[model samples]
Target chain A: MIELRNNELIFQFPKVHTQAVCRIDFQRTLRIPDDNQEYPLPPGLGSFPINHVDDFTDNLPATWKEHGGVFIPMYQAEALWMNFSGHYPCAIKIAAGKINAVSGTQWTKKLSNRPQDYVVVPDQPWLDGFNVSKGCVRQFVAMPLGEGYTAEEQLTGDAEHGGIQIIVYPMKHDVYVKYMEQHRVFNIGDEQCLTYAPADEMGLGAGGVMRQEIYEDDYGIDSWDQTSGLRCFVHLTNSAIYQKITGHPPLHKPPTAQEYTDSGLPWFDYYADKKALQGSASLSQLTSVAAKKIQKGEGTLDNNENVHPNTIKTIKKGRVVRDGRF
Target chain B: MTFSSYIRQSREGLKAQDRRFSVRQVAQRIGVEPAYLSKIERGDVAPPSEGKIRALAEELNEDPDVLLAMAGKVSSDLLAIIRKRPKLFAELIRDLKSMPDHAILRIARDVRDGDW
Candidate 1:
């Protein structure tokens, strides 16, 4: 189970009520197209093997599409929530043995606070390393959505109120590594895995035709006004076994300055400040007055009344106004 | 030759033929610093040597002898054709001069057929 603490909003996952598991099955093997060699794996689950001998002509497209497979458990989603929030500062410590005997048991205790939202993998380090006397393990802690909303809400909130649907994919590892390298922090280890995040549309399966006309009809609704549905995926590994066998970090790179900058950290700060101001404004009588105007087909104006003529024209044309006036 | 003599000859040659090439345009075609080309044009620096003249010819898609004449060197027949219809000839000449010449011939044929 992962423990997430974000100011007043603390949530834990794979809660006692949920039996969520994070499993990496190494027995699932696919033929390496390059040499027609079969390899037991979990490392290349989301990517094509870079060193394979065959020309990537045949395998690249399939590997690119299934870059990351989809299987959602409640705990993974909760961890993603923490990642998106940009609030919970995270630190992970994995032990070679069982989680109960780990040095960071105190941190694990906090996982009980919001148990329903998390899943704690007690022996993740050992399990990840089971293959080579050392298995790969990774730990990631991120502040997901600063506003404390779920991934679904962040994604579909726009669609709920005649807004655009923004599909978000997980981040990729190469990009994460590049960011880490840019920030000059190449050695911080396994707590660094990147997941893909899609920007606008979700993928459809075979025989599922997406209705492009529906989007065409509602195309003007501002997608930027909606919140982003971003989830971070953490790859847990066994450090001792991984280092002895492969001479590399189980994780890619820890946080770097570039990663912090590229991760929209500055934008989050601005968003947080803007939200605080908006919250303060909502508490005033002005909001009630505005609501009344909205109810009566009257449009609200901003602080600066130097409105554009085009805006005025649009407002007049909208249902909120009548007779070329608001 | 001296820088001043070279610049004077270049300017006289261009003016003698009533050519309309801008220094900026020449610099852009030849991939040289505009400021450096400007200095040479203004007689502040020498006109480029023969090798540099050939390079400029290659860049501007003109005959090497015409470029040498432009730099106040020997004149050539190609220079006369270029001077007649600078824009059209420049386009035609660039197409003729590019490596793997058949591609340009095909495009020219396409243009003639109004398929471009």
Candidate 2:
């Protein structure tokens, strides 16, 4: 079952399909200053308000309703992360404007093993941005399309679609049962929700690299039941357009990196057991959001100063015993 | 519950009771893919044929007739008996619908042993 409740997507699976469950939230976070230095993971401030575009067909741009999915409001240059809570195992494919976020290839309906274009969840708790390197990701920051900031624009040279896109396929029932018993891997699920973007829509651009890992699927590619998949499209609108169209005041604007740092909240680090999947060649080549902003003659962004990099609390996974005096 | 769900429960119960009655084991015994059997359990597909249901009944140690009934199928043997005298059998079966089991048993005993 898939439901949109309280601005988050909750997916539940039956006992037989236990590995097909997950919850997804689009988390608003600080736009890290992209000064070519990797940064620590930022905190999730809140969820961007999301609703079905069909609910406001009359008021919305016909293209949005025609695309037929959901919408969330975003500010230009604001950063966001996909928070995935898994209860079982699942495979998720995410794309921004039809560009594969993992492999940087054009989107395909099927999951491929050649470049491993999808993320295996439960091992991967959350995705902060595009997979641009091993043990790090370029944070996902929103930008106006056609300005050459988005990966889609840089790679494809077309600004046709602007929003994030996602699709998730569940593990086969028998494979899930077999793997759970054999490897005794943790049970959890993660699926992707897509976003459709027209010209005026906001696009996700690569931002500062943060310490986040996307795990390679330990189970073979066939573990996922390609026959059955869940897909959702999420659209992006500016806060002004969001309120004028939806009639709800926009979500409280996200705090800038400077403000968040001054507030004294610590960034985080998630330590996992396995080696993360290495970044793909194409993804590593895209320009950072801050660099693009400067290239476009916008002075270094406001409130984007780097935070004290040392102040991060490490959240360890499993029994990651530290070396102590023994 | 559907025949699919009921059989699924039976299989699951068997797993709990004995060694294991995984979808693969039961489906393989019944000559179907585990995936197909899984879908059947979820009611995504229609119940299997009478022969397969009987095979499933054998593997799960259930009564073939009962399983067939749940699958909305009459055993071929029952179909043959009904086919012998379609109109009369239809009337007889319909007439016996609400009768007490003892009454039907007596009628059955008379027809089988006492007289033609």
Estimate the overall C-alpha local distance difference test score of candidate 1: 0.25
Model 1 lDDT tens row, A243-267: 3323333333222222322343221
- TM-score of candidate 1 to 2 decimals: 0.17
Per-residue lDDT over B1-116 for candidate 2, one digit per residue giving the tens place of the 0 to 100 score = 78978988999999887665888877777789999999989989988887788888999899999989988889998898778669988998899999999777644432010000
Lowest lDDT 10-residue stretch of candidate 1 chain A: A205-214
> How many clashing pairs does model 1 include?
42
For each of the candidates, the C-alpha root-mean-square deviation to the true structure, in angstroms, is 28.1, 20.6
lDDT of 2 by residue, A215-297 (tens): 88898898877765556667777776777777888776777777777767777888887867889789999988777778889
> Which runs in model 2 stand beyond 4 Å of their true positions?
A12-19, A181-193, A196-199, A318-326, B1-116
Error in Å for residue B11 of model 1: 20
Clash count list over all predictions: 42, 11
